[model samples]
Target: MEKKFNKVVLAYSGGLDTSIIIAWLKETYGCEVIAVSANVGQADELEGLEAKALATGASKYIELDLRKEFVEDFIFPAIKANAKYEGKYLLGTSLARPIIGKKLVEVAKAEGADAICHGCTGKGNDQVRFELAIKAFAPDMPIIAPWRVWDIKSRDDEIDYAEARKIPLKINRETNYSKDKNLWHLSHEGLDLENPANEPKYDEILELGVSPEKAPDTPTYVTITFEKGIPVALDGEKMDGVTLIEKLNKIGGANGIGIIDMVENRLVGMKSRGVYETPGGTILYQAHQDLEEITVDKYTAHFKQKVSLELADILYNGYWYSPLTEAINAFVDKTQENVNGDVKLKLYKGNIIEAGMTSPTSLYSEQTASFGEDDDYNQADSAGFINLYGLPIKMIAKAKEGSL
Candidate 1:
């Protein structure tokens, strides 16, 4: 005996897993499946999705253009917090999951669907991310994770299942790397990437940019303007967040910027190796940091480093809607109040070299920092300060000498 539902709303992507999931839901539950796909800047992937979903036994297909919202509400906040998982990953997939999950709940509630479904696998962190978000919004809503319950054990098994039913797949055995793409980044996992010792064949798998060796000979310069820690312009041309990122992606990619290969610890207690391309995001982060260096004070900047690490863990673990995350964002927002400035960067051979930075609220005073005579700082005062700081050390040395 098994539970039954009259209708289910699935977080659909029109990818191989979700494509087969639509049919599986129909066959297993004998219910009307509404496929909801959120377009978080996955270009070309959403084309003809409605017709495909309907033809594959879905009762309805809903595509939501969430690009602007994703950038503003999710991505920008992560930037302000300088959120980086393990101080390496820019959290491209981590940031997109909550918004997508929020949309799934909304569609499910509107359609009066009995449950929400997703194609996230049990082994990956996405299942936790998706379900946590779903639970936050709709506490009682049942979540059907196909990868957990289904008999399919591997990607090959999924391909076989699709072939048995004549379902078309975008990837095959030869090029079956699992991927998740958004405006911020494109990630590649599985296949050769599963082995940590194997060097990634970037030329074959990279969709976002060229490798450093293949980059252009000339260095490309980009000036990013930030207001309250949010990127507002590139090369002095004012634009919205989405447009700014899009433009930088082109420039950074052409200059061979923002490619990373790492083995990250997943929330599921396992390490997974993946290669990520985040051209635009890397540039924005570097520029933002450059601005903060001049604008933010030493004490606050040091504390924010710890906050960045904590925030990264929270976001990576799918606690976006939690109270602690909200509080951390509030603090981060306050810090960004004076983070207004410009950073000029030189991109060449997979490096972001800071050419210059300027800020109206800069704490750096050249006269005070100079080695020459300065009226603001007295050299004589440091002797007294050092004596006070070294009091404990002096006492310890005296105590040992007396015994000798």
Candidate 2:
């Protein structure tokens, strides 16, 4: 038995999964489906989505241009926290999910829909991310997750369902890799990626950039400017966050930067293997970290390292709308008050080599750090410091020898 609804708002992506979901929701619950797509930098993917959604049984279709907000609110905050899930993933998919979830709720409320639906599968982290964000806004709103209820078992089954229903699909059996794309990154999962033993056919699978072996022989140098830890400029030219990332993606992709393949622990208590291509994100992260090295103090920098781990888990586990996330973000914001600087990086064949870094508020003192004789730091003071630091060791040794 299924609960009845008058209308349902769906977080539609114009993908294989969601394309079938529109028809399924109408068939199962006998409700009118209103499809909403968030344009979060999925270049050219949004084209003809409205017509496709309507043709696939959606009563109405709406596309929200969330590109600017996605960068400013979600992506920039992740950069400030240096949030990397498992210390490797730039959290491209994880970061984008919350914003999309928020938009889905907004559209549902505006359209007077009774429930919200998504294409997230039962086994994936996105199911949690999307649901949690919806819960944050609409606590009692019914979430209709089709993958948990529908009979479609696998990608092959999904393709069959679409074909039988005369639904148009962008992917075929040969190239049916499950993917999530945004301005920040492009992720590839399923197919050969499901088996941990099979090596990812990067040449065949990569969409954002070329393989490192195919990168140009000459290195490309890029200068990134940061204002309070947010990237604002490329090569010394000021630009908005969206434009900056878009430009960097082109440059970084050409140099074969930001490609990673790893097995990650999902929030759902399972391990999944995927390859992520985050060309612009990788460059921004490396450049931001380099600037922080000079601008932030040692204690704050070390503590933020721990915060980075926690923040990574929070974002990956769909706690983006929680109180803990807000508090941690406030702390991260304070740390970035002084994180203003420029970092020059040489990108060559997937390597981000630090060329130079400069910051006006840099804590680094050339005189104190220089090996040559300097009056600012007393080298002799370290002897007294060492004695006091090693006092506990001396006491332990005396006790072991029975020397009172």
Candidate 3:
């Protein structure tokens, strides 16, 4: 049974799955297909995409450049909270999805399309991510996910189909590992990465991050300036969020700043091993954490640690458009109002050393905290303070003994 959708806006990447999906949607549903490629620092990934979409029988092709928007909006906001999934994995691929999905909905509404579609596999988090955003933006709009509906199961079959139609794709049988790249990071999975013990080979298949052994020997210094929790400059030069990040990627990548190979429990089910490259993000996260040590207070600082874990799940499982995410972001924004400062870091091999940190709103008081002849902190206050602090333990010990 073919459901009636007059026009469909497909979240097309011109990749293996989406390339086949464009042709499949045209053949199966008999609907007009409008391909929308989101440029979230993947402009290089869009090489000859327009011609390919046209050859695949798409009615039109649109390439939306969302690099600046992605950094200023999604990437910066997540970094503001210092949100890291599972303590090591930065939510790189995770954060980019909702922004793309949001833009897809906007394009769909503008085009007056009857339905929206994506090439996400049912097993992955992206299917949930894309669908949730679509539902949030247009609850009534129908979504056509080809991977779930199609009879073909593997990338091999998809490759064969593309070959049958003479569709030129960047990936092949040996080279293709499922990947998602954005401004913040690049993710690698769906191949030998399935095995927990298997070490990833440094091949062209994985190019986004540098290997630790291959990194530079010399230490690189980076001074990142921040204004109210947002990174504003690199070294001594003022730069925009996107440009600064790009510069950091080069510096950090050379020094092997961010690379993670972990067996993470997926949001859907089952544990999966994933390799990620988060060059700029690693530096930023380290800098943010360094700044937070001085800028954020003890209570909000500790609480934000717990909130960071929650924010990780919220981002990883793709609830960016939901109310919970909105509330969490609001809370994060409030706490970060005082997170203004600069962090100096020394990058050597795989280690990020915090050189120094300075913030206008810093709570570190020399008068109260310094050991060098501080007048404000009287020695007498500590005598009663220690008794009060330890009273509960003291009472418990005395009651247990017969001295209460």
Candidate 4:
């Protein structure tokens, strides 16, 4: 006999998996299923989700618009840290998971639900991300992952089950490709992406931007202004975080600025090939780094690179709420205190070229770095500096030759 739940709150996306899981939860647990959908800027995907959830037998459906909060809180912090998974991905989907998980736990508590349900599959990293956040917030709440416990094997089986129950679904076997979308990015996995050697059908898969080869021949110039490491203005107009990103997405997408295809290591101990489109996010990341080049010192910048790698790993593994991630973020925030400036970039065919950068606190000195002589510097000082720097190497060489 299956364990019974009085009421279970489910993370619903109105997608193939979650749409079917809502009915399955009600049938298996004999409980009231309350569906919650978090809109983190998945533009068209959120349409009619409430009606669909209710039609599929959910007791209630809740939609939370988290676009502003997602950008200001999650995306900005990751940008400040320069968090990139495996040096390519902008931590788009990885970052969105924790926020969704946290929100789901909040809803579960407010509704006084006995358990929480999710549709993450057994092999994916999302299962870990969702469960870890849930554990962090509500340690004792009963967690139900239907994909792991369900008897359904594949997409075909799921479709058949949904068809037998007459559940309304937009996805079919031929048109089905696993996708996740948020303001920061749109990620595509499974289907033809399962085979590493297969080239992605860009026409069918791309939703945010065009292919690099099809981009316009003429380059576009964009100016972005940052105040203390946070983007404040685009092309002289000040805007809020969400609006700014939206505008940039249009601009960057047209120039083919951010499209990535890679085979990444999942936290669940497997490799998955995914195609990601992150137009605005890629432009912002590059602009931020360009501004930092002038404001941040060499040693701090080098150390932050290591910190960024660690932060990326932390986010990828779903440790967003851990104390270590907090400490690292604090460090990242401190470094950004002086990262204020304007960065002008040229975008063309998926390339981000830094045209110029300026900051009031820049360490660069034109006079000191010039080839001509200056009163502040002496050419004779370098001989002593080189000897001191190479002392260990010279001593080792002398000892080997018995000249010590």
Clashes of each: 0, 0, 0, 0
User: How do the residues 182-213 of candidate 2 rate in per-residue lDDT, one tens digit apiece?
Assistant: 99999999988999999899999988889999
Instruction: Give me the runs in candidate 1 sitting further than 4 Å from their true place.
Output: none
**Candidate 4 local lDDT, residue 139:** 93
Candidates in order, TM-scores: namely: 0.98, 0.98, 0.97, 0.98
Candidate 3 residue 33 Cα shift, in angstroms, is: 0.8
Q: Enumerate residue pairs that collide in model 4.
A: none
Residues 1-404, model 1: lDDT tens digits: 55899999999998889989998998888889999999998889899899989988999999999999999999999999899999899999999999999989999999999999999999999999999999999999999999999899999999999999888888899899999999999999999899999999999998888999999888999998889999998999999988888888888887779999989999999999999999999999988988999999989999999999999999999999999999999999999999988899999999999999988878889999999988889999999999999999999998989942
Off by over 4 Å in 2: none
| Overall lDDT per candidate, in order of appearance | 0.93, 0.94, 0.87, 0.92
Residue 31 lDDT, candidate 2, scale 0-100: 97
Predicted candidate 3 versus true structure: per-residue lDDT over 9-90, tens digit per residue: 9998887889888888888988899999999886578888998898888999999999998998899888888898888889
User: Looking at model 2, which ten-residue stretch has the lowest summed lDDT?
Assistant: 359-368
User: Cα RMSD to native, each candidate?
Assistant: 1.1, 1.0, 1.3, 1.1
Q: On a 0 to 100 scale, what is the lDDT of residue 257 in model 2?
A: 99
Candidate 3 residue spans exceeding 4 A from truth: none
Clashes of 2: 0
